[model samples]
Target: MTVLFSNSRNAQRYRAAFFLSLPALIGLFLFHYWPIADTVRLSFTDYKVFTGEFTFTGLKNYDLALKDPLLLLSLKNTAVFFLIKVPLQMALGLMLAMLVAKPGRDSTLLRTLVLFPAVTSMVVASIVWGMMFHSDIGIVNSLLESLGLPQQGFLRDKHQALPVLAAITIWKDVGLSMIFYLAGLLAIPGEYYEAARIDGAGRWQLFRNITLPLLNRTHVFVLVTSTIAAFKIFVPVEVLTDGGPSNATRVIVHYIFHLAFRFNRFSYATALSVILAVLLIAISVFQLRITRDEDDD
Candidate 1:
């Protein structure tokens, strides 16, 4: 009789929970899953630009993508951008988090300053940074001249353009990363540090062993999100360079956008989108698996 009553209560609670979450579930299907399914479907169909028709072409788009030189170049550039942005962003974010982890007025001010750029519009930020890095009239060049250094063709130089874009984005996005790290830092118990000090553990030892190890989940979450953000780098490239200076910063998303909108090759662009989605999923799964394994060990 008791078991039956318990089961009945559990079922009622589940039904209540489901009813509460029903709207979100419906939104998830309509907005996220439905678009994903349509994108996948479109990937296999060839869209006629002029006629507004989609004819099923099976795997032809995928096969052509394999032989596309521009796609390969974009992928390589995107990888380079990722390498530059993710490492610096992670390091700088962690440093900032550590700096402001303690509760104080100074920490509060510092947090506000750090997050200022994040709240600022990305387009406005991109434009302002682009002007600042201008070779001739920018403040950066003016300072360089005053210091007896040559002006750099920042956004205009093919080799430097991608890195400049990465730097701009890192500045804009690092605040969010810092917040994640700050949360991780605060969640760490004070007792851990006290015990470490009791055992003759120095600051470096505590950070290396206790702090780092305990923040493993935070690291995984931040890393995965940052990696995806890095991979989808687009706005800075679009607003500032538009993949100029010999296509130095022609990252994947920008390329796909140009293909669909500029060139009107919608089908091929959808195929690239599918590829990007799969790549992101695989990378995220791999990161989670690695973190889980480390936890197990």
Candidate 2:
């Protein structure tokens, strides 16, 4: 009788644990893993909405994506966007976190204002920025004219469009990055700072030696995530410029969307998406490995 009861209790515990994890497991399969697997499978076939049928095209889609000039241009544009946005966002986030780490006069108000952008919807933010960047009648141009500076088209000019888009992205997203940095800062032990102070370490020396070293994980997280976000950027470009001013601001995601919906190139678009996913995964793995080595030491 005792043995039977013990076995029943163990079985009940195992079932309870499984039930507890069911929701998250379902979410992972439904939202993330399953969608990725579906996309991978779709990449090999000529799947389209109107046709309602698909035929395996093997690696033809990938070959077309590779040979396409616009795809190559989109890749270059994405690289440039990542290079400009990620560092700026990280630096701005770190600065905001440091400034708001300890409340001083008006700090609460400052924090509220800074975080407002992040809470706003991205579509709304893009629309507002679009209006602001309007060449002839926009607020930005008006201010430039008032100051007697050159009144140039922010989005209409091919050379200027990507940078303006990057700036908007940084403004809208930096608040979230700031919050992450703040959380990281809070996780750090105060004893480290106190010890450094006792050792006559200045602000710069303490930040350089302790804060940066301790925040390695946060740095890696921010870099990898921000880079991925930059690479996947689509809405702002789509809404503000429609991949134009001569496709100057066209990134890979924008191209993929156009290929799938506008050009009816479903297979090619899926192939491009798979390539992007692979690139992001490779980058994340490399970053994790490097950070793990640093942590081990």
Candidate 3:
């Protein structure tokens, strides 16, 4: 009798827990899962939000997206941004993490200072950077002129625009990567360092052998997430360059926005979005596999 009563009470507790989590589950379905499902459906149709009309177009949208020249350019630009931004961000973040890894008042202050830019609103940061990079009256140009150097167009120049935008992204987001690396660094036991030092292992040797190897998981996480962010870059391009200077900074997300809103090619935009989603998912899966293999090894 006692055992039956306990089991019944356990079942009641489980039921209560399920009920408690129901609201959040419902919210996820309504907001996230539903939108993704709808987007996939819309990608196969000629849907226009303004007209409230849609026709099933089969694979026409995908074909058109594949053939679009601007779409190809956007893809190239996104790849370039990822290649440039991720390495620089990771390197700087790792350096900052190493610098502030020790526990002290100075370290705490330095960490806070480094994290300030990451906590700032990205749109606001982009706007401030845009102003700073202005041609004639901007501070950057003024500095160059003071040094008797030729003033260069930053956002207005085709060759310099994308790289400058990538730099801004790295500056704003490096703090997040740094925090991840810091956490990884702190989690590593101090005994390892002590053991290495006793064996005459220098700082460089200790870091190269112990620190880098142990940070494998953190590196994987940062790389995958940073790659996704680079591919989804839209705000900086929109606010700073508006995909101008001969379509130099036209990233995929910005192009999707332009197609959906400006050109009213909602279906085509949805197709492009679907493709991007697939690409990110594939990259994430590949990274996960590599991480798992590393762990196994």
By lDDT, the best candidate is: 1
Candidate 1 per-residue lDDT, tens place, 1-297, comes to 556668779889899999999999999999999998999999999999889899999999999999999999999999999999998998899999999998899999999999999999999889999999999889999999999998899999999999999999999999999999999999999999999899999999999989889988888988999999999999888998998889899999999999999999999999999999999899899989988999999
lDDT of 2 by residue, 1-297 (tens): 566678879889889999999999999999999999989988999876786888898998898877899989999999999889999999999998988888676767777888898889889999999899999779999999999999997999999999999999999999888888988998999999999899999999999999888888789889888988998999999899988988898899999999889998887798999999898899889878887898899
- From the highest lDDT down, the ranking of the candidates is 1, 3, 2
| TM-score, structure 1 vs. true | 0.91
lDDT for model 1, on a 0 to 1 scale?
0.94
Which one wins by TM-score: 1 or 3? 3
Candidate 3: regions farther than 4 A off: 1-15, 294-297
Compare candidates 2 and 3 on lDDT and give the better one: 3
Where is the poorest 10-residue window by lDDT in model 1?
1-10
lDDT of 1 at 198: 100
Per-model TM against the reference: 0.91, 0.89, 0.93
RMSD of each: 3.0, 2.7, 2.1
Extract clashing residue pairs from model 1: none
